[model samples]
Target: MIRLARGATGFRGPHEAPLPRTEAALFRAACFTAAMEARGRAGEMVPGEVQTFRRAALSDGYGRVFTALGHVHLPVVAFTTDPVREGEPVPGFADPPVWAQVFETAGLRVMGVKELMTPLEEVDVSELSPAELTEIRYWKPSCLGDVLFNWWD
Candidate 1:
């Protein structure tokens, strides 16, 4: 169900239903990171750290939430994500696009990701036949539904 977090910012809309406290914590993390990145206060992100985070964020659907949480933890990164555009291909599908600046809070600082277009690739495509693949035009489908939001966040 869509929800809202009415703060000074007044963010409201399709909030992930039943967001668990743990996931909410991570969301806060991403928000903080985003804020930090926005003000140029985010710590430097090492090359390896950047790759690691990119991999994690692109590994699965949930990774997007992780990245989002990362922004919460750093704030500036959220600003870097810039426009969080979520598109609905159908009744139960959404693909969110963002321009993010990522930062590693560990050893490095101010290593932010920018103009990031991390597409959440769909899964369960191993058995796709040639015709099926052709019909789909690609092994991975777009606007992956349940798989994209089947979690606490």
Candidate 2:
């Protein structure tokens, strides 16, 4: 089972996505391109652009962690998105419960692990206070506009 912290913001999302470092950098590039498009600056002619965006959407580290956190334990949880399942269905998943069972076999008394697919919208965002937001720097991350424009020469 995988567990992660997400929602470093109030109105966004997270997950335990496994992406190559190169791919992650490309994902950031795609985000910049999309932002430019929204501002009518980027033309629609970039090759392999969608692939980067799709990578960003799929392997967003926070999306993976936040989504998983809603389902997994708070602090003590193990998670993985690498060697992901591809194509047709596989039998078992490495969710919390499965990991618990493995731990039991190893002589550890695990409480329980349940699978949940609740959407990020349903998460208890109200728990985040303004002070917490400030402390976490929810606004410090790259804003879409800034991310689009900020770059090396």
Candidate 3:
């Protein structure tokens, strides 16, 4: 059943679910690493240190997101090859278009917040417990990014 969280963020949840495309995660890892390298942010990154893995979310259709959570101290970095306006800030873990292009050229499709948010109308909560939903209500994610990637302590 699809339901919107009763909070200020207006996040819709439990939409029609699609399993995370884990196969693309490693490609995303390479893209992220390349972006970091292009930005000179790879100085501290160890090869194979950028890990791509999935995590469960309380309010999302594709509750499991394939992401790279290492090689930097950011809470979480979601990679995507979606086009970005010049100098436009990409939500979640994204670099510049030039940097993103590297992965796009390689034929990898990493989901951005927009792509991730599109399936909000198709949420299915059969798997989530009542406690999890309650916690999500308290969190009040401001955007899909918050729900998909976070460091909730």
Candidate 4:
């Protein structure tokens, strides 16, 4: 099964995803775009133009360098049009679990190598390779966002 890990280049690792790297990137882009739009509609935050897009890995260092993925991962940065108190993080960046929940509520699915349309909660840590598990231990992920927005490499 595919294990999700967000990286600089994009989601990567030895895990096998159902879609190719390019397609996966595009899918993630679309999902995030829709999610941001929803957040805007709710008057929570205004979705900004994507600051950057992650491509595919070029070598063994997945998510370290750029490669020709079919699609790109649009990492959108959102902001609040209204003034906020000091020390407050941006709306979208403030709470990642909430943001990930937005995606989950929208019916977005993270595909696995063997499982079709698996939800984020169903992702099994036991399926991960020993090295990946070790990485997870190091990252100490607490929720879906941590897994999806990591710098494992």
Q: Largest lDDT belongs to which candidate?
A: 3
Please give the range of 10 consecutive residues that has the lowest summed lDDT in model 1: 3-12
> RMSD to the native, candidate 4?
13.5
Residue 150 alpha-carbon offset, candidate 2, angstroms: 22
Indicate the residue-level lDDT of 146 in model 2.
16
Question: Which parts of model 1 are misplaced by more than 4 Å?
Answer: 1-22, 40-122, 125-142, 149-153
lDDT of 1 by residue, 40-75 (tens): 332322121211111112222233332232221112
Q: Every model's Cα RMSD, please?
A: 15.6, 17.7, 12.5, 13.5
Q: Tell me how far the alpha carbon of residue 4 in candidate 1 is from the true structure, in angstroms, after superposition.
A: 28
Ranking, lDDT, top scorer first: 3, 4, 1, 2
Query: How does each model score on TM-score?
Result: 0.24, 0.23, 0.36, 0.32
Off by over 4 Å in 3: 1-33, 36-109, 116-126, 129-131
For model 2, the stretches where C-alpha displacement exceeds 4 angstroms are 1-73, 81-93, 97-117, 131-153
Candidate 4 C-alpha error for residue 134, in Å: 1.0
For this target, which candidate reaches the highest TM-score against the unseen true structure? 3
Backbone clashes, candidate 4: 2
| C-alpha lDDT (0 to 100) for residue 15 of candidate 1 | 47
Model 4 agreement with the true structure over 30-115: per-residue lDDT tens digits:
44454454442121221211311222212111212112111133222122223332233212212122233333343444322223
For residue 99, model 3's alpha carbon misses the true position, in angstroms, by 4.1
Residue 67 error, candidate 1, Å: 11
TM-score quality measure for candidate 3: 0.36
